[model samples]
Target: MQLLEAKLHKIDRHNYRSYSSMRGEYTFVDFDFFIDTVQADPYAPASRVRARRKWALTDLAWLKDQSQDYQRAARDFIARQFADLSQQENGIQIDRPGQVILDRTAVVFDEEGIELRFRINLPADDRKIIAKKAMNLMTFTMPKIIRRSTIARELPIEEMKRHCEAVEDQVALRKQLEENNLLAFVADGSVLPRLAGNVDLPMANAIPFECPAELAIELDAPHKGKIRGMGVPKGITMIVGGGFHGKSTLLNAIESSVYDHIPGDGREYIVTDESATKIRAEDGRCVHNVDLSPYISNLPMGKDTAAFSTQDASGSTSQASWLQESLEAGAKALLIDEDTSASNFMIRDERMQALISKKDEPITPLVDRIALLRDQLDISVLLVMGGSGDYLDVADTVIQMHNYQALDVTAKAKEVIATHPTRRTSEGSEILPLPRTRQLNRAALKTMLEDGKFRIQVKNKTTLRFGRELIDLQALEQIADSSQLYTVGWLWFQLAQGKGWEKQPSKAFENMLNDDWFRTMPHYGDLAKPRAIDVMAVLNRMRKADFK
Candidate 1:
């Protein structure tokens, strides 16, 4: 084992620090016997004892130590000799041999932020008999222990090292994420288009802009080694995972960023975006209460008397309806959720566009309205989603939120491209054209919140100040009759994440259509779990309410 360790240290980049140890046996007889047994039957003996090429599984295992394993040998054999023959054939020496090692790495699953342990693999075929034999035995041991016990699942350490290397390689092929920029969070607006559905950045506008690739944050922050920020990519970045996996808390951290942070949010996404709005679901819909029954067909002309307040009105637009108009009036970015009534990619597309298609159309659709504002008006939209659609097909980037973490599908797409070079694109495409227009109004978004305040700092000195309107939390309590309380809460939470949520939740549904931001939210894709259902229904209601 020490000699093998010595050999590995001699190999560049795959070496673990070595210290001389006298614990291992110096004799070759027992070691050879152990080796011969493993070299034959890795799991069971092929023949009785003393038979040529026959060995006992027990004899080989009894010789196994706490560290060395059997599966290690077969894996090393597979890696160095069998793993990357195609790479070698293609002139890429990505694999040496399927070598086994004790190297380790911790990988974070999506947004739930679960840290899964993985073994690193080395490419060398030459390995000590002790280590190789142990790993093969583990392949059997792992599945059993996982189902019944809390034991750590043993992975081919060499495989982990190789896979981690492969992960970097896959990330390298993508142009948007830099090597140094990777394994961390990115908050740059330029990266926004990827999440925001390939929407172009607003140039020469009221809002300052930075390219996604140009913006840099770190994965490790404050007391750790420097790296780019964790991903909180723009467009509607969603955090999804199983229960107790931290989805609502993920939203909480984002909400923290919108206001003055005392401890500040630990989430990399909010820290990076220099956000525009954070909205909660409790706020009712923001929309114009024009008699929709005339053009909107089924919608009732329910006039507000004691129910809807005229005091805090942003004019005739109700929370849901005004969003469509505000976005048309020009709001740079908007984030809402499944809490609205939006659903399915193709269905939403047809209905949403119908409503936004010219005034007086009987069937109204939010998608068409949003598109009009995005293409014709230049407002970007960001709303949450939970199912499939034309949205996914048209999405510039799809962020799969398995856990609490966020990974741009653009990253995943690049991975598929790397393994299959024959595949279309292995890298991020060129920057799309966007009209550099429209200044971000942080004050407007905050005024839509409870005691929301705005502070802007540029070039180290000049500061712009904006004040927010006090939200009547009591009104939230009073408006139990409204359909958008959750929608309001959701939008508020989004704004609080440092981006700033300006419109009421209902407005988000109306605003979402015909806009770029609507294109980015992660989709649950028709799954009806508790967390996803609570969120998706809210978004759908707000969306459907517009056409109704």
Candidate 2:
């Protein structure tokens, strides 16, 4: 602590760049502080720092003995606490988590103790450092925040326990999906609708979800115990309803349920398969060497879709590419919403099929292949369809969401198919081939970094700036946080260290994202663990990437 104060005092009123000399470790009375990186200008990014306290001193040593998931939740809870505490101080800031609790690097636990990784703005007047202000913020305000967050007594003990238990319960429920033969589970009382299109919070007076008697199943939570929810079976399931009837809302909840929500977030008890991917029509997105022959083939002028590569793809082509890419990255189930999907890609009506004969038409819609995906590839699909009944023929489970409540309409859908049968022939091949694993060129990633001076920036959850390329990720609905994107960029950086092509990029990423995923990356608090499928999905959107 004295060393930090002396360094600040020595640079009193000096230019902001002079504070760079303060980049080093310092020992405080109760904890040890390390200034890892210093900011050059006051307006630049905040200085990186870490404060670690011994487990013996924290009175929270029992956390070290908890399960890995429990410990991760505890760390996340502490980071949220530190963020709340430091909110009153302008200079001190920590990465605040959102509704989902992710495995983040903000608050980490090691054998020795707990460490809080955060940033300090380094108080400055214009371009000059203010020594007293810096001292007050770091030595006084920062330490207090750290201690309050790390110490068990200073925290809301009951609330923290509830938070951790909620997370554990969600994990337990997710593990029950495969055994129950379900793709997703939404608790009977879950609030499916959000406040608005822009907000992610639960609506105040929205109707709670009620599973029909036929679809309800029970799962056991380690803490909560005996959770009753709607079990969306591992097959072709369609959510069908009228406009503004909560069909999309139910699907949205199912998609987001792939990640466990925080307590009181309305969807906390809901759980989905982690490998379920929500894919939609992303127009103008880049596609690299993806096999889209199943959905599209024999284009004009003798074009081939077996190795489709496009800088600007149409809605149907983009949707097809995303589905194939998701499968290649090990997606077990797919979530689709008609509102955001391509009309032609989802289905071709009987009238259109008769008008434009199969020989002349090159495109094959998803309606013909959805069942094949389930039967041949052992993949499940959950779709929200409002305008079409063609899917009713292939749907094994039909759920109608009426005013945020679900009804089992499988029998009704079967009745509809029997009464008003269509003559539209299935356009795609009978067998659905598994997606081929495309090798990624490490040199291509290296080139992207070298061309842009090695920079990685994330703008919310919509975009990522890696090297010189600005990849748009607005269509990836399953990315729980922007911090996950940060980790994705760094993961690519790690992958770039090698030479030649990576044989199986998805498996390689899965291996890297093991229990201690953050250890290999830079010691930054803004990193969160991302799924291997999402990592590969982002890479597929990079226009400069080379895949074969």
Candidate 3:
């Protein structure tokens, strides 16, 4: 045992805001002293014994670990040093690895004491480490403290674990929301209305429809591709595309999206409209020979007179009546394909077309019908048509089901709109400076045609072939740089039919028709007759004056 004249140095006066620490050199001067000569104080000092930290740092923390009793000796030494402090206010205080400080009887001292000092070794391995830790500590960062405060240079392992857990919880909640399948339905035919109209969200429209971000389904060949869903208005939406292009599949999938059904049946999306009536038809039965009398009146037209029926007595007056009843039944949307009409145009013809129009009165007819259904009934129509049908003329927005899925046909729509000239017409336009109306005026053609330039055709036999007219050849050559010229020829041919007014069908015209205008324009193989016929109808209606 050695005794020394003990002396202490105060290194720092300002106490650390949180846990306290101190340091001072302990130099033991061993000297002779009789065991019986010691004197004790009258009263053991009122101050309690406080746990002391190591003032002098050794060369290595684990230097003593090399010995056989390394762990036991080190632990026991620390225990003896803190033995007196444990009985003080509450417990002992001691430094642990990884910068942990435990207090109370569980580990270390309890009484809150002002920090005495921080020892600095002139040149030692711990100097840099201590300095690094001191520099990293930021004071006054805790918002809950409200005032100035200080924390350890490093955060506690437990606090860090808790912080990471909180962050993970937040991430998990977001993922759950994404997985929640917001589709509108239940197995019982119910509807979970959408929250908003984001294109990525399942619920897109305010009514019942949802704009889908990525809608994909496995279908038979010729119908492989993603079917995108756009936001539908409160009114009808038309999906027009060519045959064998997966239109019906898309419609069926849409129905499935509402209610989760099997792939061929339902179960894709959960639709809550269990009570909602779905009048879908497959094969020919209901679609092929539907009785118009159920919905529209059986008008006594001589051709359809095999079964005598009263027009007034019938619940339905025409094919339009069937559609009308569906609308009246509070049906959200009508999905129709080819061969539904009694008359190709409609039962009431102009009347039916007028009822489905964007507006009423002024338009030839469609505008009026569109206004009635959209404004009054709130029912939407999903019509699938081939070729540029009359319904396309009134459609507010057309979503085509081409390439086996749904696509917005806005480009085609805008092209048709651009062709439709209003009152304003520039002087150099190829499309004639038309009047305000979109439909070509049959009366105007009679006034403009001269006897010499006119070639009349009766019974439509001699009117198929038409030559191409040059329209800004410089632009045409630029566009046809490397691609084929199918589209280019079609455009010029339309111009020729409209302005040139062919007097005779020429061999050159046939050659040009067969030539490659552009590889892109639709191939007219089996579809050639229909394509040719549709083009001629437009040509016959267009006047030479319209091109001027």
The lDDT of model 3 is 0.28
lDDT to native, each model? 0.29, 0.92, 0.28
Mark the 10 consecutive residues where model 1 has the least summed lDDT.
45-54
**Number of the top TM-score candidate:** 2
The Cα RMSD of model 2 versus the native structure comes to 0.8
Off by over 4 Å in 1: 1-227, 232-252, 264-269, 272-275, 278-319, 322-330, 340-363, 369-378, 410-548
Ranking the candidates on TM-score from highest down gives: 2, 1, 3
Off by over 4 Å in 3: 1-232, 255-259, 262-267, 270-318, 343-368, 420-548
Each model's TM-score, in the order given? 0.30, 0.99, 0.28
- lDDT per residue as tens, model 2, 426-530: 787788899899999999999999999999999789899999899999888888899999999999999999999999999999999999899999999999999
Distance from true location, Cα of 138 in model 3, Å: 80
lDDT of 1 at 520: 34
Model 3 CA lDDT for position 114 = 13
Residues 83-151 of candidate 3 have per-residue lDDT tens digits of 322223221122211111111111121122111111111111321223222222111111111011112
